[model samples]
Target: MDIGVALRDLGQVDSTALIERVLGFDEQAWVENSYRQKQYDVHTLTESVVMIFTDGKGWPNIEVSKESGWDLLADVAMPLMHKIIERHYPPGGTIIRAMAAKLLVGGVIKPHVDAHPSFHVGHRIHIPITTNSRVRFMIDGKPNRLAVGNAYEINNQKQHSVMNKGKEDRITFIFDYVPPEQLQRMQQMQQASQ
Candidate 1:
């Protein structure tokens, strides 16, 4: 259960299309509906997330017992996303949830653990599309910055939080997947090679 604190880099991908797509959206397109943590009543931290693929209910609802389906907006952006997913995740794994999360300038996600079964049973992968050095992601109280275009595997079962102190919004594509045993073996091989 101790997955270590190092950020596992899954290499980089061309995030041009993804960044363009996100930047093209209207200002009102970002929806503020996240159940991960409660916004502070005194100092509200505005954030938003769009579900591209999910358990079929909708955004903000992480618990689902049904098959995953794409949202209408996701259908339109599936081509690029599919390419990214296929290149990284490939097939044979169960991807329970996928979304594009946006943290506005000066926003913060209070520290909390994603204790849901869905989060505990899978690995959370993050592909930062647009980010800056000021955007900090804290996992178990350690702050880390995910640079744009790089893919990283995060241990979401641990206590984590995000803060956007940059002047621009921080956007990232996140996916939850139950990785196949083969993938684990491959990672072990990689570690041995190192």
Candidate 2:
């Protein structure tokens, strides 16, 4: 699977609520550099990420060696997060990480594959809150634009990159989870469509 579908509508949820909460954070709250900063510092994609939920050790620790914990920001964003989880995931899907990622205009994420063990075999879902047509999320060279309020499952295991050529910032609520059957079903659906 490449650029995936919206699997679920997710249209009724007010995406602005999540966007407002994300924007409420102070400048210092955003994690400017990607975790793999050493490798691609020159063309680094700057994202203002507010980690709402993460492994116990906190942000930048993508590998969950222990139990997970909700950050302080999660309290403010819990209502919307629950709504998202309920809509997409099963009763007890394992949520590895959840964050509000904001990319500024002209920002670009150089092509790279997230090859971590945590990323493999899991689904990375994006719920775009504020975005425009110029925001291109490329998966294996094909460009994809996720409209506001819609959810998309991106195949992060493949080489992918993002560029926001629009004037407004592109904000998305990203969630990583290991669904028992939904991921398999989505892949099958993609194959059938192809």
Q: What are the TM-scores, per candidate, against the unseen true structure?
A: 0.69, 0.68
lDDT of 1 by residue, 1-194 (tens): 12465366777777676667666766555554444325333124543445533442322234433222134235534555456557766566555666666777898877867654445556677878788889888888788878887778887767778888899988887776655664455456557766
Q: Choose the strongest candidate by TM-score.
A: 1
Candidate 2 regions with alpha-carbon error over 4 angstroms: 1-12, 31-43, 52-72, 180-194
Q: State the lDDT at 89 in candidate 2.
A: 60
List residue ranges in candidate 1 displaced over 4 A. Answer: 1-3, 32-46, 52-90, 180-194
What tens-digit string does per-residue lDDT give for candidate 2 at 2-99?
Answer: 32542334455656766676767666566543442334452355554535333333222344422121353465556666676687667555666677
> How much does candidate 2 score in TM-score?
0.68
lDDT on C-alpha atoms for all candidate structures: 0.62, 0.63
